[model samples]
Target: MKKTKSYKFKEVDLVSLRELALKVKNQTGFRLRYGGLLTILRTNVEEKLVHTLVQFYDPSFRCFTFQDFQLVPTLEAYSYLLDSPIAEKTPFTGPGTSLTPLYLLERSNLKTTCQDTLEDILALLIYGLILFPNLDNFVDMNAIEIFHSKNPVPTLLADTYHAIHDRTLKGRGYIFCCVPLLYRWFISHLPSSFHDNSENWSYSQRIMALTPNEVVWLTPAAQCNGHFC
Candidate 1:
């Protein structure tokens, strides 16, 4: 008997990203105070590394336009992983245990080719957001608190100085904290599946709706180098 060819399944998430985009778009200009929403988006001690990476891109991201960030790819990728079962648990706090989400993403690689591709997509979305402008206040500020901070212009210039060349800079403290906050925030607002059974939602729903606000804040900066400053 002839051996059978294996089949691979590929999926993408569009709805989820759109929903998330809408939320981001709705950000009232009320959050437009001094430091503003953009500041939070740019907060990072290692700004130099962040800027260098962003500058290498094709069109070169503008700090303002929402579409310039290229969110579609990430949305498509994240949707694929959203509902899969956690086959194993790896505690992430130390050298021996690989518990971070990135490490876990590696594990998914052995299980499916799509896993690696999905991870890449998610990373790209994060990259665009980080490169967006005046994100310092967006880093640690509340969706509402974004309007209360100060010095967005100076903060942006300072960050640009930091982001120009190094590849070693990681993420800001707030960036790491923000990921979970965004996750939790996503859970609170999304449908029940986002917590218990995310598989049923449309690919777009999963991708867009689950975008944590904190993730929006930290992802761009996180991608600048390798660490979450």
Candidate 2:
């Protein structure tokens, strides 16, 4: 068997950004479209659990293969998690513009410069930092392109798979995709009994001990009326 590489998971601190998102969410349609993004930011990622989950990733297959079952992140799952519509439009395909963040801010046409510009900048920051972050503290053009599409679920899922595949091969590196959203999608499949009774066990131990029948294969709450039950 080929030795899988050691990998690190990195997530940006979005506390300050979350506050900005809160202020602007109602100003634009942001709350209705991407509210789940803010919700997932509040979810605490158990890094140990994530690391153990990665160990089961079959890079060639691009899905988690445990002893008796397989799992993968799906677009529907992400759309539900994000509370955002899946755009039938194409996901971003970009050779992005070189505009700086300040320049981008200046281009916004809202009459109320202070409020409107703040909202615009907040959207960009959320895209760059929270949604498709490839660097710490920097919003690159790829993020800007995705922001323009107003379509993120496909790209989000693609980035996640790509990040895992890349890191699994690199042997030692950070997985830069949205960690919290991925973590929530993962644990949502666990049987409720496991969560209720496994408080004394380490996350890794609980996860590793799960049998196929113990996993919740379908979470109706995640699929019902686009709201998590």
What TM-score, computed on C-alpha atoms, does each candidate reach? 0.19, 0.80
Q: What is candidate 2's CA lDDT for residue 202?
A: 70
lDDT (tens digit, per residue) of candidate 2 on 1-229? 5464577876675666666556663633655544565576567787877887887788788898877778888888887787777889878876654445445444443456565566667767767776777755567888888877778889999989999888887766888888777888898888887766436887656766789899877765455646433
Worst 10 residues of 1 by lDDT: 75-84
lDDT measured at residue 158 in model 1 versus the true structure, 0 to 100: 28
Expressed as tens digits, the lDDT of each residue in 138-191 for candidate 1 is 212221121122212222232333332121133212221122112222222234
Cα shift from native, residue 208, model 1 (Å): 39
Candidate 2 deviant stretches above 4 angstroms: 1-5, 22-29, 33-35, 97-116, 196-200, 221-229
